[model samples]
Target chain A: MYLFRNYLLVFNILIFFQVSIFANNRDSILVIGKVSNNPQKHYSYLKPMLNYAVSHMKDLGIKKGKVLMARDNNQMIQYLQEGKIDWITESIFSALIYQQTTNAELLVRKWKKHSPNYYTIFISKKGNDINQLTDLKGRKIVLEDPGSSTAFYVPLMEMINAGLTLEFLHSVEKKPSGNNVGYIFANSEINIATWVFKGLVDAGAYNNEDWKKVDHTPVVFRKKLNIFHKSDTLPRSIEVVRNDLPDPIKKRLKSILLNIENDPSARNVLFAYQKTKKFDEINEDINNELNRARIVLNKVHENLNSL
Target chain B: MTMIIQCLKKINKLIFLILIPSLVQANSDLKPLLEVLKENETISSEQFEKIVDAVDNNDKNNLGIPAQINTKKNDEKELLIKIDNGLKISTYDGSANFSVGGRMMIDTAYYSDDKQPIGDGTEFRRARIEFNGKMYEVWSYQLDVEFGGGSADAKEVFLSYDGFTNKRIKIGQNKAPFSLEELTSSKHTTFMENALPNVFAIGRRVGILYESYQENWTFAAGFFGESFDNDVSKEGDESWGLSGRTTFTPVSEDTKVLHFGASLNYFDQEDNSEVRFRSRPESHVTDTRYLDTGKIKDVEKQYSYGLEFAAVLGPFSFQTEYINTHLERKIGGADDLDFFGYYMYGSWFITGESRAYKSKSGKFDRVKPLNEFGAIELALRYSMVDLTNGSVTGGETDQYTFGLNWYIKPNIKIMGNYVRVDNDINADEDGGVIGDDDPNIWQMRFQLDF
Candidate 1:
């Protein structure tokens, strides 16, 4: 009975969130939003593309482009609801929130890093004897930031589904009691890799793509690490426009980005924009993939938070 | 066969229909699936309506609806773009890519002659264009062509595949798994030139290498032969070799790291049976080698091993390596020889920009400046090589070097190194110069990469 009440409460909260009011703060300029703790890097990456997009949108009343950075996912959602940001590129988990909670339109799917999907992996030292997700009990694992889908939510979901009880570690020194897995957020992928490599924690979780990237998971560290667990493929990142954005403007912006790869002049600009190859329309295949992804994402959000 | 497949699909839908009346929830995900089937003509309109009515719809849930589906028309191929990351000439699916980049290092040296006349001049140390890229995501390749030393040569031309789990394989001309100092890319090396002990490192050879690494350690091994441009005129059959290296890091972070590694190289000179060991005085402007073994014949096998250690703490870093080489005379009694060398170095960034270290390759990466002007670093190194053992008094020499570097940009830098060479009595260019000679060398470089 109590479980049912909790479900009811979660459903009510989700419904309340879905009926969000978008602020009509539209102006002559187009605002591109990003969620990042490192504003400088994110700004430079977003600026050129925003300028390119705005340049092509002069006929649609977009005279200039501005980049706004949100420090976290929740803040970015608030910005979108308030119409302070007209367009945003987001990872799957946060993108799901914007899609469900507000009238934002998913403009196109961004092939981030040129791949439409990436998976999360759980890593431990080579000889930890932790071969599977269940072995993480009574030990600690490190994650990236709370805003990360691969580093945080997907792994959290896997643990919950595996029936492992979770206890949040306030510090590395803290330990979980019997039969519980303790976890902490290390703020960056490299930090998570470092903590696991140094044995400050029993394991770490992040995307498989980062596992291959030398800068994130150093080659030295990879020599003695073991990826004991992997999650299902998650949806790639997405681009979305606020619900109230003009239809013509939204369509024009999307058309420009989907065709950006064919433009010779935008070569460096596209390369600098984040190694994006081209945007894709969310076709039937993608729609089905997204359905599965969102279901698990919703459950992860609702189930993990109360714990 | 197509008709059979279509029939199988319809049969699956019939099963789905038979089960849904008992299992379907009004807000269940099956609504989309049903709509898809109907749109694709898997179910007739009459049948769809009948099934839609026969199912007892439960309470409506508003948990999973994208607003665009309810209020906006999304069938149009409108677009949106986002980028935040990676490589070049990349395919849309990230399966293939290509990029070209290279570096130009122009150097000048002033040799303070002591007992020998060493040339003092400027030259291009390394002028090379490199083409590198990935194909099919897991396959990668690099081709580096060097136009230095008044000639053109291929350096580190290789193709690699990383498709396996936590492992990679490379085949072509590349560096053997040997020294931490030798493996680090020249573009990011602290000093303009490697230390005196680098002569013991058998650098870039044609080979195939296998590498596997985990969180705290790495293991690399390879089979190699003579360099690409080896002369077949005197060819009694090229020497073949095997080399392997293993490294472990107890701690690795953004600004803190501790690394220890060991390597072994074995060469079989079954037919050639001759070798020479030589090195410059840690400076390239003068081709005069202060230490040279000339030629040692009747060699059957060559054995070498190296030990390496390095660390980085904030803006300060330390590295040391020791190498030992032993040769087995095929037919001579008591004619075996041994040569050993070692180098220790430390560097600090006074401008507070830490030397970037790549734990992946166990090497120091390029350091970028923090401020607009540039970054400055002061470094010192002490290296010793003793090629004099038993019957082979090739020579022995030691060097003390001081270096200062100014990195004006990530891709451009200026470096100055002052080296003092101390030679023993047998230290001469294969009896071509006076032994016990000492030289003070000052060298500078202007480097840029694109």
Candidate 2:
């Protein structure tokens, strides 16, 4: 009986020590990333930018910037809720989700790859009879990964608004029942193009930027395919900070990033960071759009969960 | 006999009436049996006709047995091969994607008024097949081989690690980081071939390179050994070099850009290194080089520095580069030789399309047409090279060129260039003192990539 009590006391002490360490380390800036399609590939581009941002914040007791890659959206939400991640850069869809679940606030809009905004474009083979969204019934559509806003959610919401029933399939080869449009996840923009071009799917959807990229949709394929529809534009990407972060650090980070372009020494660092053009302050119109996006995200979540 | 015939007819009628219903229910197989019965005189002609009519009616009414349906299982595994844009094959799990592509360029030139005969003929500029892909999403590789100009060559066979932020480490045969023109892909260059300064650009070499970039700038440096497929070195000697380039863009946008860059190259020559610099009259098909720097002997080390500036404002873009090369001799009391060259060019798009600037390499990329018809571009350039310094007179030359390019598609283009060359009075072009001979050349190329 005495030995058991001693063991319990030792365990309690260890737990207390771990809690203290974690509490002290909470002040360190933690950059969180969700593995969208390719974890390693995405992290490779994010790490340098995170390092540069953290290095500029050394005056705020930010000695280092650490990256924590979440396996999925759910895990990312859990991390935000637990206050484990202090900052995040994500797509509009993910930003909406975090805004609803964890109260993350938008800090700035990142001009990723020099593109400030992008819109979804629905494409089909030139001779396929699918000319409009209504004609997609009973046909299969390929989409980029679920995390992509323009490729997945924007088009999906539009389709839902059109009163078309959608059924998710495990692969592109699966057929849908009559009166329902089948959709499959391609996990990449190029794969979506391939699916539509090779007649594996009746239609495909992605951003206009990808459609124009020669590498993604080569000229040979573009000759045989045509865009049938396009969605409204949305902000490309944004940087967000946890709402509970200290206000001083927030202002300082914003100041540092917004003025990074003006500094000649930071040129190479900024160029390496995914060719980031510059960070701009979020405006009221963007805020309203984000709110609307939140509603769309909620509806999408309900539909997917029910399915 | 009449009574017997009447009895047989009656028997046939009764048999036909009984078998007609079965024939109607049976498939096409029963029709053969009915024909046999009629042939053997077991049934009358009218009875046989009635059976055939019933079978045809049943088939139309879907009452016949499903005509020996040939059902196939369709068990063939779908080969995940895709040829929509480019040829690509991928795994179902999205872990691997591979693509095969190639490009070809056919060039022809006609030169006039050359005192020292310049060959005017047609030649294949580049015919290359390239294979590139990413493995496990973090490692990427490219293997390119060229078969043109009556010879086969290897180009850009390298593996790269892109798992770093805005940075990549490449190891293999690749262009040493030195000049913007040399780094930019050949398919995207503004002219058919680079200017005279390209002779000192330190082309592709076997090397290990590191590259990183930010929004408006890029920095690349590498340590390189002798070029791939170079001649075997003598015993106890080998060639090696180091080169680096940095570029900064003050203004970089889709339609506007201002770029500035600098590069440095240093190399140690092997024993008996005979280095020479020469160029033709802005044409690749001509065998005669008007500006020839004869072999410089007793060389130990060579270094080159270059300055570059480029600006793009909508349909108008301008670019200029100045390069200087110096050689340090190994023998004492032998004066070192110095050479310098510069070129400036400007281009305008008749269709109002701007030159596409690739920020990754700080160079120009493919020009995309805004309209359906296509885009047309016009360019003019002035280049000069001086190789006569400190008694090693390799001669000097100046050239002016005008170019026209029609981009019919992203992968297909037709280009035409008219060049005028003037060499110095003491130029020794063909191993002899051939006095200043002016030449006017016209070149054209049909290029395609996939």
Candidate 3:
């Protein structure tokens, strides 16, 4: 009688734990929003594309994909990993690094203005005699954020190859320009570029796509700033899904995306974005390119360590 | 004629089935009937399908016997027996194996000063329970605890990685490397516990450890700071230390085995708390070397150096070690006190058998097994500790111990020993006249380690 009672007690406890785990796995939809750093300058250009993607979420069987307006990549990656967002459209470089530590995947690539290659340009403020990379030594440059691909990786890599390393010229009080010969995160590219134009920083770096959208180009920057260097063409932004999504659901999502431009049902969605052409298959060919980028990025990291 | 023959075969099978059971029961087989059944043709495909369906649905009578069923049952029985653990539903098979081992000791003593009995004469110092086995090729673990200590405390609870290199990376607390005497397992130590010098010199430090062994050489090192006993508060006070020791046996299958090792240790304490050496000194005569003096203060700076050697020949084995320690304290400006301790101890098996030290195992193999009864051993050790510059007491001492051991079985032992202590005494009250400053004393102990 005692043995029978013990067996029943153990069975009840195990069932309770099993049910608890099952309850924790209940699924829910994630919503995300995106915004340009200079909303007045670039929001008009991005609004249509953002709205179109949201409308097509149901055809993609997402049922309820919500749009949130975050102005930076850090918040996007954080929310995406925490399941607050199911998919993210970010630059290839940012996607490459975030995927290393999270279960996110590259779902689609953005055909920016229908061009696959976008390079970052380094600019200096007006009245600053920094015309070349070497002259920027002992001068402060502003990078939008730590995870920015064109704003951070490109300019940093270019400076390293030219032997102009990241270093401090003098004490803060002795700095030729308050921001000269140092690097600081401006939170947004517009703020970073404005800092350079207003003489708050010596120079600044950002991607060509964002620069093309800037209306005024800061008359001060046009007067003093010079494009010291430009990085190699970087792949455009890609929409990444979670890595552990069910295979069947993933297949359906992929089919819907690859057929988006061809299907009349997805026409309104595709029409919202001007530069988008059509969904393309992502396979070993694209993976090799990403691998090459990773190697280059790792080398740049190693270079930073030596400096 | 063909039809008649087919019918005859069917009738023969029915008759044979009826007669064979009776024949088997009678212990007298009918050859013709058995041959008739054996000569029957295979069943038609349609008939075979029906039989298979019946069997699947649990409707078949199963009159026909299976020859291999008995053989399979016997194999399973053999497997269960091998894994049976005591009376529990346990077994020693490919899935699991149990190791029965322990470390038991006895410390007997005598002192030159009758005023102090530095050694704890109570024997049976330790009895440990050790279990190490495996579930499959990739997963293995060990659970070992000391029973006779103050409480049954866990010593080693670790899972090992055995698939890759010749060495194993153990991901749990085991032993720290500091002193050769400390590293030498208590089960095979010359004395019950380490000497008075060792107690102050080395104590158990726990942390993640990695060890590798190949042929005659064994190498181990670790990063130790946080221990299971004190996990929470030990974080910020991060005083991490590392130790490594290597032992080599040059010749293969030699009666006289040799073991040698060296170790280094350092501790960096945090904030106001300083790292220090913890030593318990033994007073032989009155067992109170310094009642007049206050308790010893914990020091700040700590460092240890050690070397050891052991050899086995025929029925006798010898072990020796030398350790030098330097203590760093704050009260006095950079007062670095260094002292050295060494002892040469040996044991002889009174029984005819010789001591076999297993290289693969960091332990001595079944020792002194008698032909029928049991085995006996006699051992002697002498050690001196100089505390003149001890940085704590400012005293000097020496200890002498003689011991005898009896092995009742491979896993059991009975031990007895007598130790003497001699130390400098400042004063004494004897008939209004002060006796000799240095007094003499004696001590004895008995213990069992399984």
Candidate 4:
């Protein structure tokens, strides 16, 4: 009787398992993706970091995924909501919008050059005698892209923090120019670098990556420009996952990923990229910092709205 | 004559009552002509009549004058075609769109004068129809149909509900996701059709599919399956089965996207049922011998296995898959056959643009400037399969393919490929000997959307 009962129980369990497959069609997982926009040409500095991420997905159970090549923030967000993706590595502005709309979590921030920081570098022509950030108050300045994290956000924030009033002496007309001191979306850092070198803009602000590429401080503005100020370091890019993901799977993925370098099985994929060590533990301090950024932006938005 | 005059007077009175005060709304009114107005209303009517009179005279500034020559503006809607499988209908706002797409491939095989010719090289490959779209903010669906020369003709439809729960439940005809090529959209296949190994175990299937995806991973499970083209009535109780597949890209949102995947299928055939093959036939028996399709068969048994791999790079990428299967055959004499096949293909863009994605800050842009002429792409593929591991023979087949593609626009592309097939015969002599005897085939395709 006991044996028969056990067999019956097993049979019953099997049947139940079979029925649930069709009965439950309502489970979900987060989908995430990011693109370097331009790896070979513009964002070459960030390529090593991306390769590290690609070579080591087996440790996280990811087998086949697509890296979308995109050129605009709008396209990136569209992919995210289209079920074509779940996660994204993007600028703070884009991430802010996604987090607010999708309730996606900010998992971890990257540390560039082994430091969790970044800053904007202001540059000018060779010999025009623009020594201070304030001195360019009424002059023209070139901006890389309106959505650029470093070229726009960092500089804008620093300006506000420093109480430097911005009066659009005149908006930079989007014309193809070697150099002109106006807010122009050059579409690339090299273009911006070239513009400053050729005496197009009176001054400009770019991240350290762009600054490092230029051999001469300024050829056109060789005597015109000087570093007026530098902003404080901000957090690097972040890795985020949807909060609704299963805890166990998420935990396993995170554990395997954070310590990928130590796992023999994951070394080759991880080693493809550089400037990445490991995912450190996240805590309240990081959250607090993110909150501070949000607060600052909210204030700006409120001011804009009131006006 | 007097009566006629009196009637005329009454008609004039009625005309006045109807036409005098309502003259302002006359443009909107359609009525019988010839009416009279009361004397008192005639003053108001006179003013109205003056307006009408002015309009009747084609006055330059009358209310009845043509409402500006440009009142009816010609606002035309734009049409965009997405190449994924359908032609999408989008409005000016781009917030809403509906897409309808389809594919049809008729391939005839002509078996060369080999020692044994199974059916020569001649048969219809596939006839397909697909409907897909994003209805609004939170809904999307895809329906597919297949009709062609095969063991069976069938219809497979999947109604997908995406976004509501971040889950997609496909109820209809599709794959169970047991293989890498099995889950990829057929439209994007490197070959005109999937490998023969896929036809045996991971062919297109029909079932209840529940799939969930995260940034780099996808988990899908389903049950109550159907054969590739089997009819619902023929299934009976034996038709029931279970299948599931999981896919993950460990490195997503990076310049190089890497992925891994695994899948399973389990079935319980009816007692005394001769249903050994799933959707595709395992072997073709002839007077000479049997031609294997690379499948393990069992009358009443479970089917399951695992597959894993990675895909990486930008304008260039590569993929690999490993599979294992066991079968329980009804005949006591033969054991289940086991086989494995792996393929790697790489693609590079000679043009400035990159692969299309839904992100703005990515390598490629669909809305490239008009100054750009077009994009050129080159791809190479190599695949090897060992089909005689567990059967009566031991033979391995290898193939190399090279392709060149021209993308004239976002919605148009022309592609041509040359493939070389090499065979290594080690199994029974009946397996056919081709001491590296090779064959080269050429194919070309032109694709357009929208």
List each candidate's DockQ score.
0.02, 0.07, 0.01, 0.02
Docking class of 3: incorrect
For residue B266, give model 2's deviation from the true position in Å: 1.0
Candidate 1 Cα misplacement greater than 4 A, ranges: A1-93, A97-307, B1-87
Weakest ten-residue segment in model 4 chain A by summed lDDT:
A38-47
Full ranking by lDDT = 1, 2, 3, 4
User: Each model's fnat?
Assistant: 0.00, 0.11, 0.00, 0.00
User: Candidate 2, after superposition: displacement of residue A81 in Å?
Assistant: 18
- Of candidates 3 and 1, the better by TM-score: 1
Displacement of the residue B71 alpha carbon in candidate 1, Å: 18
lDDT of 3 by residue, B1-450 (tens): 999998887786566446544445453223443333444553444544433343322211121111111111212112222221221122211233344545555445544444333343443455567777544433567788877656877877778765433446776767775555665565555445466557444445566667765556667777776455655654356556666666676642424677776767665444324433223333221234321212333446567777777788756888777777676665655465676677778888766445666564333555634323566788888776654453344344466667676766644566555655444442222112232234443444344444
Task: State in Å the error of residue B384, model 3.
Answer: 1.8
Could you give candidate 3's per-residue lDDT for residues A37-153 as a string of tens digits? 322223223333334444554454444334333344544555555555555556777677557657677776666556665787888765568777777777777776556778777
Once all C-alphas are superposed, what RMSD does model 4 give against the true structure? 18.5
The C-alpha lDDT values of all candidates are 0.80, 0.78, 0.55, 0.51
Candidate 4: residue B178 lDDT (0-100): 73
Worst 10 residues of 2 chain A by lDDT: A32-41
